[model samples]
Target: MMFRLESVDARQYRHKSKRVGWTMAALLLVFGLAFSQLLVQSFGSSFWLNALGVLLGLLATSLIFAWWRRRPDMAEVRYVTRLKQHLARVSAHLSTLRQASRQGDVRALDLLAFYHQGMAQLETLEGRTMDDDAERLAERLELRKQRQLHGLPEEVAGFDPAELDAFRRSEPRT
Candidate 1:
């Protein structure tokens, strides 16, 4: 699988790579020493056997290290996966809001608010602009709002505090 290091810091990448490299080297060294000792005992200090063991050990270590170095660190993988999932959720929510708005439903206004909140969350998470979808939704919401207001009398165009109080009083208290 393809791996990306773009989300990870350079220093952290180097530190983790070094730690893995050292751990692998230590394990190889221990294995090489034990194997060489066994070879010597079996063959009575044969020069060729000892040399072959060292050569194979070095080759294996190099190959493993190269493979490990090419792979992305675990932390970076998790971070990128999380970011993708979050963006997917944001896109889905925006699409739902757009559909609701197209139907001219009054409840679209509340869903639009939720869409804006999701965009704000995306912006904060990525430290970048997430306003494209939100801006489109805002324009559609504004048009709907104006159309709704045009159909209403001036006296009923604004919020009614008495209505809010009545609704709140009707709700059962926890």
Candidate 2:
């Protein structure tokens, strides 16, 4: 089952449950050790020290175990944030391309190249960008090509229009 902390009541319940569970476990452990120590000190000799030693050792091991369990959450949050930022950067580059293209600036070609490179990297990172957006981008590039027939012709440049169509077809719809 998925744990949803989306609502205030759910968040409160999780917080309270976690606090109660940890508190109860700690109290039980402390009482267990205290009882063991008292029994050993009263009914045995030189064994309360050993009991205390064992209790302390278990406490240390439990702490290490808890840290191990919690460490992955931190790592996952870090990577997810990084991936989100990377996606934003790619989108920003695409925006730069669009703006430069609108201004009829020659540098827009360079920006378009950079945007394609960024998209390639994003594809490798998570492949999560919307397929429709990619198709629109490819269509826009095709329109730009027809408008500015100044670049090398597709035949002489060994550029296959079919490849662009193939890429659009291969992507999954959003």
True-vs-predicted CA distance for residue 132, candidate 2, Å:
2.8
Q: 1-174 in candidate 1: lDDT tens per residue? A: 111113345455445646876878886896677667778888878788888767767777778766765575546434444445544543554555455455654444343433344344435444566456776666646745744654622122222234333433543354
lDDT per residue as tens, model 2, 66-169 = 67445643343333334345435435445544654555544444334434543443344443555568776784576357437546322221112343234335
TM-scores, all candidates, are 0.33, 0.29
Q: What TM-score quantifies how close candidate 2 is to the native fold?
A: 0.29
Best by lDDT: 1
Candidate 1, residue 54: Cα displacement in angstroms equals 0.9
> Looking at model 2, which ten-residue stretch has the lowest summed lDDT?
1-10
What lDDT score is found at residue 136 in candidate 1?
Answer: 65
lDDT of 2 at 12: 40
